[model samples]
Target: MTNTQHEPRLFADEAAIRRVGEGLIARTLPREDWTHEAHLAACAWIVRMRPDIAPERDLPAIIAAYNEAVGGVNDDAQGYHETITQCFIRAVRLHLARAGQADLPTLVNGLLAAPEGQRDWPLGFYSRALLFSVAARRGWVEPDLAPLPTVMEA
Candidate 1:
């Protein structure tokens, strides 16, 4: 009925994907597939559910919460609360650490073949991002644009 944009997503316009990637660089320009809010919700659920094994199973609901939260109770973007992105990253890392894992990145790579050295976004962006998120929130992964602050003192 209505003209849809960014559809058949795998075939999404390269320009659009580039724009999304660039926008992901900074929080300034938002993408059609914003992950932050959903990431937060998922992270929060992880904190609550505290799965001892295979936490990934519960991830979808968390993403949904984030998506739902972002748009508002009714999905109005204004209804979303800006996640304290750093805190979210830190929390996930801490959770993983406390869960007795080696570290977020190593754990992630072990789980998903996500190379720690590459600058390229994952071939499976969302899956990789979700796992990497644990590292990001936990402070295992440090990026300049991140909202987190340094805690370890020299």
Candidate 2:
């Protein structure tokens, strides 16, 4: 009989989480070569991280907003695209903004410190970084934390 006990996830460690977040941010620039799977993964991660945002509840409106902003091209795009992820990220931001929860660092930290089993920590880490990137671009949040040195810089 094969014992199927799962190994405990360690990405919840602050350092590990920071590393994952930094890695995602470092690689997710210039918007080059982002695959459909990656965009879907980001959306999935975001939903998992913030179930209260309820992608089902917000995705339609988000998509509509994205389509409107981009001149309705997104509706004709095939598969999971960067626009999809961008829309979802913006939707989450809008939801939080409506609730007056604009402290992104605090939100990210709280999600990181959540019980490991309750969330996909690695994906959550990536999603938080993605969210930060979007927020920073829109001037919605400031990047005020200690910078995580990337592999290229190290």
Candidate 3:
């Protein structure tokens, strides 16, 4: 749960999402720029542009590497939250599917405008205690508040 409620930094075009995604992959993005909107934008870009990389299967490691590169840690208390990442992946994938074949900027912008794109979106499904727990950070923990959409639903 690296997200905090604040004004979103909207993407102006496909290039903006690309910069976040490419910078994240290369571990070159500045720590302060990895905002909640940026996280969703990067995930959307990865899900749409990079066919070889499966976000659900690979993003955890990618994020962990990026965290370390930015002088962050992936310990139990912080960094690389599995539950939140998986939830966002599902939400982004579903949003992408529903969006059909839109431009990256449109899709990213739309996502930022949706409920799931908000910094506190996961709170709708997870209790703060469970969502921010050490177990949740290290591995996926089932949402205690509500059931998120399943793969079939997505």
Candidate 4:
């Protein structure tokens, strides 16, 4: 796969993202996924930029391998997450702009970086969500925490 810096960005809404988070918690982290190449890449990036986050071994592959053994994987989790992050970042910036809270990116990054050795966390899905949430609370992105509306029978 080529670098994404040259590729166009992808974005998604809150519902799908929450669903992705759930997927991560259920399918990937606890069990694992087969197509973990993407996860592997993401992990490598985190490790490369912040060695403190790097595991002693290939964590993403291990997680993916584990989830794949579960015999079921949701194909859309990564797609949803990517979409949410891109859009969430934009949304947070816009929200801050309206409220006159500038320097949104720096604040959110700092929030994400608060915990030491956060990358060493065994669970990638949880870490990713944790990072996003901390960012949201810190104004790195908007809290789109939209829920899937409940249905009421008439």
Best by TM-score: 3
Better of 1 and 2 by TM-score: 2
RMSD of 1: 16.7
lDDT of each: 0.34, 0.36, 0.88, 0.32
Q: What is the descending TM-score order?
A: 3, 2, 1, 4
Off by over 4 Å in 2: 1-35, 74-154
Q: What is the lDDT of residue 64 in candidate 3?
A: 96
**Candidate 3 backbone collisions, by pair:** none
Best by lDDT: 3
Rank candidates by lDDT, best first: 3, 2, 1, 4
Question: How far off is residue 109 in model 4, in Å?
Answer: 14
lDDT of 4 by residue, 39-135 (tens): 3223323332335533323333334444565664424432223333333223323333333442423333332232211232212223446444534
Q: What digit string (tens of lDDT, one per residue) describes model 1 on residues 103-134? A: 33333322122121122222122244543453
lDDT of 4 at 32: 33
The regions of model 4 sitting more than 4 angstroms off are 1-9, 28-66, 69-154
Q: Against the correct fold, how does model 1 do in TM-score?
A: 0.24
Model 2 global lDDT (CA atoms, 0 to 1): 0.36
Which runs in model 3 stand beyond 4 Å of their true positions?
1-5, 151-154
Cα distance off (Å), candidate 4, residue 110: 15
lDDT of 3 by residue, 2-110 (tens): 2455656789888889999999999999999998888899999998889999999999999999999999998988889999999999889878877889999999998
